[model samples]
Target: MVSLICTLQDHRDDVNWCVFSAKLLATCSADKTVRVYYTKDFSELPFSPLSGHGYPVHCCSFSPCGQYLASCSTDATTVVWQMDSGEIEAVLEHPGRSPVRVCAFSPDSVHLVSGASDGTLALWDFTSRSILRTGGVADTTMVACSFSPCGQLFVSGSMYGDLRVWNLELKQLYAEKSAHDLGVTCCQFAPQMQKGTGGNVVQFRMASCGQDSLLKVWNISYTPHAGCKMQLLHTLTGQTAPVLSCSFSADGQMLVSGSVDKTVTVYEASQGTLLYTLSQHERYVTACAFSPMAPLIATGSMDKSVNVWRVEDGCSTHEGKFLPGEEAASSCEGGKMGGHSRLMPSDWSEDDVSSWLRQEGLEALVDVFKANNIDGSELLALNKDALATDMKVESMGLRSKIIRKIEELKMESMCTGVPDEYLCPITRELMKDPVIAAGECWWSTSGFHDCAYEEGT
Candidate 1:
């Protein structure tokens, strides 16, 4: 039921990967530049392209706190940029002069781990801006690296299908195993779950996907005597083509995968059930990620677009029309289709309408009912002829009201906005730092200077 919100076509070439932060989205491209846009307003163009890389930028990741951004390129370098100012904080060069493929920050945001084409991994300490450690020269290109939620361990995947786990504190290899028949393209750890009283106990798991058209989940547990043990939990198979990327939702209850087959698949994490298969991308889907603060998924594709999908109740749902070549099939069946059906007043019962109103809003319900010239009792009575007459007279106004009400409810629930009292009177914008003078009016430091003469006059 996933539908495209909008197709972002800012990249001149293929978009390699995309990462989301609280307020911004950073997209790296094969055009040798990285572009960042406000997640709240995608229509606005990027202020400027991040253009220091000499080659194509392969991947980008935001720190856990969303204060900084890290981007790697085929130019054998990784650049750390301050998110607010877009200033380069550090430029890390690969020790072996190999192209950096993937990079990620530790859960504590103290260290950064990056994998390179020369079969090596480097850990950098951001505070000191120096390489803390470098290892992994097993003669296979390392493509992916991820730190576990506990920040005590990390996992790396190689082009030769090797997956290795290492102790972050000791820098010692903990386990090595073959993960797939082809190169491993992506790896990620599931969010830690609360288990015991007071949420002190945590459960850790990991999932990996690769060019072998397979996805595997593993259970990771620590033992005092044995150290660490990773057990295979499940093998997921659905994609006919190579799976390029996979990500677990913020709650770790859902997993999403994108592949060269031009499809994105959502899976129930507990039972491994296929929740939905999204197929709006005309070309290979290169990357997919779940938003940390919202029920949305963002997918980047080689078709030169980024699509946002809505996830609800462990299923995908959207209100938009189907894209070109997309089939209008049932979601219960096993194919990429739009399974959403528009609901009519006749389709809902009195109880259903009442429940919806309680959950959505009584205001919206009242507005829609008034616009359609139908009482709650009449709506539940299944009077289609009366509805048809009302629709014919004010069809556009009724529809517009319904749409606007829905949008208003959604925005009120999903986004948090700044208070009006915190805004400056002159610019009508948010005041970063406020100073109060006579009358107790708030003004930013710069605005205070401009209004000082006025206040004196």
Candidate 2:
């Protein structure tokens, strides 16, 4: 079901948390540094390690678009860094000067939240980089927090074994007094919305791991009349020791968790059945995150090593990796591309994109793309970030394939060496059906493939 692809041993101390963007991997450590890696081969970035935190870093998260990373530390602040240049974007000080234990960016990347050791939570307007409001639980350390897919609600877990849900206005919507018996270590909302049982109601699923040695799945629903309601769906007991962290696959079909027993467990999220139990970490497993667009996962531990795993669906010969750019482009040329793109990919309409997706054997995704109104230009703009985040593609392999085909289309549109004879005379586009007229010298340019000549002589 899974195989270890590589191991990263860059952090000098205990690895606290691990997170992934479309293109990069970030891991924070008790050594007071955060290391970034390229997921293609698990290679370190040029800047390698980020050392802005004055004290040990406890958690790390990447912004929605993979352009920035946020890391919180015992130094009493959460620092946001530009992903490309490895420079600090802003240093956000937690309220009450307490050690920041956790941080997360909303689905839209418009807001950020940081939880402190004193139970204080600060919500920031990410664009303006200013605190918007403050709220928290009483007498407990804020250790876990995650935003809902709708970007309007978020849930925070405390050391007091409570899970509290809050809106952007800092108003408490729901609170489960003892969601976890001992304490909560981590929680994350599944990235999709489900229709509630009634009209105008919305439902969501969230996964949380705790010191109680249990991995719990929850269903939370909200409506104007009833506010928010939470119910436990399943409690998995596959891990022997305390479960420290948990994450959901982009499509929400699977869940993964790391535990103090030095093992990583993968679960079939829908049925709560254990899929695999990985024990590659030497010390306590502390962190785990699934790549946004690939069937790959990274897990970090107290052993000071990050293990990169390739999840298998039992089909790919590429061995859990994507095809090289050149090979992918050749596949696109060999009729793997969508329908009627015809070298003018940027001129595609919503209907055209649908037709293309259907032709590419992605009929299941046609509605998903149509709901988003993906046009020619929008389809061309589909990167790993948008495919996984905005479109919610489930299979890591599908995300990689779609992106590869899109890149090939982009390359075709940039080609400037087309011969004049192989181009349509009137449209100046590539001629797919070139033909000679009755005179043999007259080229048929009338709307391509058809000859139209009108004259009064």
Candidate closest to the true structure, highest TM-score: 2
Candidate 2 per-residue lDDT, tens place, 145-249, comes to 999876778999999999999988889999998888899999999876665547446678999989999999999997544679999999999999999999998
Clashing pairs in 1: none
Pick out the ten consecutive residues of candidate 2 with the lowest summed lDDT: 327-336
- What C-alpha lDDT do the candidate models reach, one value each? 0.68, 0.81
What TM-score quantifies how close candidate 2 is to the native fold? 0.73
Return the TM-score for each candidate structure: 0.66, 0.73
* lDDT of candidate 1 over 113-153, digit per residue (tens): 88899888998886676898889856788887888765657
- Candidate 1 Cα lDDT to native: 0.68
